[model samples]
Target: MAVAPSTAARSIELPAALADWLATHADALDTSPALASEVVPRLAGAGLFGAGVPEALGGSGGDVRDAIEAIAAVAERSLTAAFVFWGHRTFIEYVLQSPNQALRERWLAPLLQGEIGGATGLSNAMKFLSGIESLQITATPLASEQGGWRLDGGLAWITNLRKEGFIAAAAVTSSEGAPPAVIAFRSDAGGTERSADLDLMALRGSNTAAVKLDGVHIGEADVITHDARAWLPAVRPAFLGMQCGMSIGLARASLGAAHRLCTVTRSGLLGRVESLQAELARAVGQMHEGVADGRFKSAAAPLFRLRISLADIVQQAVMLELQGSGGRAYLMNHDRNFARRWREAAFIPIVTPSLTQLQMELQKQAAAAGAA
Candidate 1:
């Protein structure tokens, strides 16, 4: 892994060859859903999917920082690819942290190698952890068998639901009123249906879809943890931290593009570009410090705030790029890069745990504290 200068906020960088691959294919991936579905295996072959995973888990050994930086590096070239990367790597994380050794052993290698895809159908689970929503899926006991569960309910939105093969992690409430649990179910399993990709304004290639589980059966072997209340807290830090990398990379790329323009025709915009660049570095620095010291694991509010800040910066950077490029960026030909980045910027605010949702959560927390 290439390391950035100490003064830089993030230390990790993808190899030039991998970076070039992402940049070269970014437009195609953005326009073609068929090509986008192939993103996991393509980047997996480049060894881009395993940065933060442990060697024992069949991954190149590193921590969450490495993972976040790797994703950010990819995002600089292609947010679509970065979105897919986040989904696949986040699932790898679930398996790594899961208590079930057999679950890890059975799935980790294939997931790590990118032979099969992994989906994180856990947006509701994260919200559920925050007390913002209930678990969307439910598990009922199997009267005929000891360790079987019947899952019903669905996720309205999920990414990386590849058509080839995939296993998704979801949280489920139980009919018996047992503590909520996290479980993995495969796509090929009966009664599990993935809808056609949602008609999206951007990220058309992300393989995003909605899924329904009629009576999907899962056994103890599928359980990531029997107590999601406990498991989610432990894993939530890495989860949101890695997710923030998407914003970091997009902001970096947009800022760099703006800076390039400012040097020649748009020198007046230089001050604004520098200000956003500095803010991006500071936000990244805060995230790295929190992840290293475990502050984000115990308290996610700070990370949530940081995620919001980065989203704001990403929007500003993309708009700045547009301003600097002016009429040239509006062209349908090669200069459409700015238009694509603009659409990607629009996605940052609405991604799961959206800016609005985070703002509401903060308000609720404050009101409760005031009452206390």
Candidate 2:
């Protein structure tokens, strides 16, 4: 069950009490799924879950920056919990800002209350657009059910499907002369089924899986956002916010490991770790500026550049750690988390609006500006 929202008008401040609690619980949350499951529950208990929901809907009505701070702090301790919180906030934001009031009242409130866990199902089509080309999902309308639609598609590599009550997204249809629209439904709503969890190289504890929608039924109330083109522009920044938090977490972990190594081993290799740390700091600063100035307009191109830089830093920092610590860093527990983070960082460049494509687009823009 979800905790009730606070009655008083509380300022949107990052409570030190919550931060201390998170730090105390960090090891348990990082090590155990049972403890990690308490993440949203604990957040709701602390009234953090209501951070993004509007006050009219029994929430504090905090802004994006507030949400960012909360998630970033959580990321520093547990990346899996941070991912879950980030997804919850982003989904709620979508529901609140959506033109569909009925949808907001129906899905958003319960979701915020932790009665339902939600995942965004946009990555399937996004992967297809990135030229993965072998999508196995389809959504078509059903004539038997009133104002109902049927979905028969499979989305591989979906996050939070195993534990969530439902996932949301736009589904491509056979309808002609009309733009595609978003559709969502409960994960166990009759015909809906999920594949076994995928053994991912990174974010191992995220409960990601391949979701198969086998003739799943959805009603008009499930439509979150109708405009397909407007979707990316609206939500890109919020998604980037989570990635920023993840990058910061990776950098912090790498730096901590490097510092530990420097204390025991003295060599020129320490200089390389210091240089990478400086580069990562500069990249993070630039990324923050781009996010602040709204340079990442849509399609995640500008943000992708920052992600690529962070990945490079992670790679270099990992090498420096190995050099500074000798062969012991390769042991199972010593550097396992860092290795997973590095693999996850590598995956950032391959997702939607891929880095290669973004580079070409950037080149065209630069050439045009140069000519002008």
Candidate 3:
């Protein structure tokens, strides 16, 4: 008989510098509203932000698997930090996937070098393209001399830090039959407005906010794709793949907490925690397979299911900690102990491929598969 794999099987490791910073700051990140403008440069300087950038483009020459590992490591410590990295890396991945040489040369090197920081506002766009929601942001053709398009619209789920930050965003065309495009925008440019930070339950320190764009001008240098929907087909797998880090890391961290505290708890409670631990192991195994085989697209269904499973497991793991703990108040406090992880787990149900959204798409797929 074949031997079963270990639950602690991690393929790639985070750089020592990133690990050290996380260790020093994880408590503060968890306890306070950490500022991205202050935090991002440190993360970037530690080489944490460039894992998905390519070497030819002045990056460290890493790939999707490397990115996932690094992301998971951060998530395991502080979901706030993990969330901040996710938004930044999403922009990096988007630019890397683009065929725009001018865009890559102008931004990729500086972005990888930590000289600049940016947000990614494509979550809404991703949902629209996936039919989960309608498109909101838009772009209109500019005069020939302008050499690009004019943007007017808003994105609600972007992570913007510095006023000088850049963003990778999407917009529909003003004219029918004109393909939608994904473009880059500057945070401080005229016609760009950002809403005050939105209060969040779990990842409040992540700098999540809305961006309103009115006549924001773009040149050829800012265009990532002329056809955003078409563009989705090329990059969706990688986009979805990066999400694995968020779920896996969160689940692992919660489960690890439960494991530490369950040693002296009741047998029944311990059994329940053990069961959730087993489920987490399977989810991590599935993620590992996807990364190793480069089968994100083909493995999309399983990968998505694993995501839901991680969310479910995280809820149980945190609850188990509450049940097994003596410091019950800390476990239940909004900003303390396992309570924070509970709220963080709550986000999984609403994160882009939310539990409801995932179930809807899965049902749709099941019907289509049966008809075939």
Candidate 4:
């Protein structure tokens, strides 16, 4: 049976005022670095930085699906802002799921309030989790009297490394061969350095940067999980599920444009639009069900498939929008609507746990089973 959109899904609506603001400034946010860096505080002011978190943690009290919906709503206006939202919210999830109550209690309020940016510098960690890569950072235990570990390593690319202030999470392996540990530390911590923003074809204003840790001290309070191998699987669902929001929002916007153009122009493309929309609904429904029922937690292959499907659907949606709109969308209008989304769709495939990475993982799983 064709799975339907999850009836159990809860919708998260961005405030009309904030939506209007994003729509008006989406271009500037994408093009202007300064404007993009300010997106975190703006989202906090709109009371959306904590949409998916529990109320007890100073959040608005919804699940990860609500978080995904919130991101999609912002993405429909400005993907740059939504990218920032994902990084920040994903970090919040890490802290919320951490076994360390002290860490959660210390950081949740400020993070939820957007007082400090949350950089989920975990793309490499996720790859590491999948056995595709090893942990990037190394940890050395300090003397017994001076507790904590000194970390040295770097992340090639991470988002939400804000200038004002931020906290970042990373997985570090010790030379002693102990299991990798997931830890959080402030961006301003000594020996921690953030590079200038990376120049990109789009979303340049996303505050994306490389981070280097040189003898950075991480205390017991900073540890999210002592066993990254075990903990990562538990949180992987939320991480990937939230990332899918970007694809969802971008796809919906492009498809909506295509559908509208087909209607107004009496174009035959409406049938194709409807077909893609149905596929999109199925992907979303599956994601919703997986996240809610804990299916994605124990088995991530389906989630990976869903992520791949969404990326493909997003690209097709953008192409359909471009075709339906004809010459008008090709023009460099002030809004740059079609042009921006086209660039945004290009990003979907390359995002962490990218389509290529996920495909390889599926292949590995298949090969292992065949060998067995």
Candidate 4 lDDT (Cα, whole model)? 0.88
How displaced is residue 208 in candidate 4, in Å?
0.3
Which digits, one per residue and each the tens of the lDDT, describe model 3 over residues 297-362? 544567667677777776776677666665663734533646666667777678776777777777
- Deviation in Å, model 2, residue 263 alpha carbon: 5.0
List model 4 lDDT by residue over 1-372, tens digit each.
Answer: 011133556565677778888888887778778686578888988878677677677777668888888888789889999999999999999999999999998998898788999989889999998889989999999987879999999999999899988999999999788899999978888999999899877898789999999989889999999999999999999999989999999999999989998999838899999999999989998988899889988888899999999999998999899889887886786238888888888999999998999999999988998999
Q: Which ten residues in a row have the lowest lDDT in candidate 4?
A: 1-10
TM-score list, all predictions: 0.96, 0.76, 0.87, 0.96
Model 2, 1-372: lDDT tens per residue?
122233322223446666676656554444444453555666666666676456788776655545555565566555666666766666776776678888887876677776666666665444443344434545566677375667777666566553646555544543433455666767768877777656654454555667777777777788766565566566666666555655566565666677678867845666777777788767766665555567766535667677667656766665666666677666777755555444545654654445575576567667877999
- How would you encode candidate 1's per-residue C-alpha lDDT over 150-196 as one tens digit per residue? 99999999899988888999999999999999999999999999999
| Clashing residue pairs found in predicted model 1 | none
- Candidate 1 regions exceeding 4 Å error are 1-9
Compared with the true structure, all predictions reach lDDT values of 0.87, 0.61, 0.69, 0.88
**Model 4, residue 77: what's the lDDT?**
89
Query: How does model 1 fare in lDDT?
Result: 0.87
Residue pairs with backbone atoms closer than 3 Å in model 3 (clashes): 180-228
Identify the superior model by lDDT, candidate 1 or candidate 2.
1
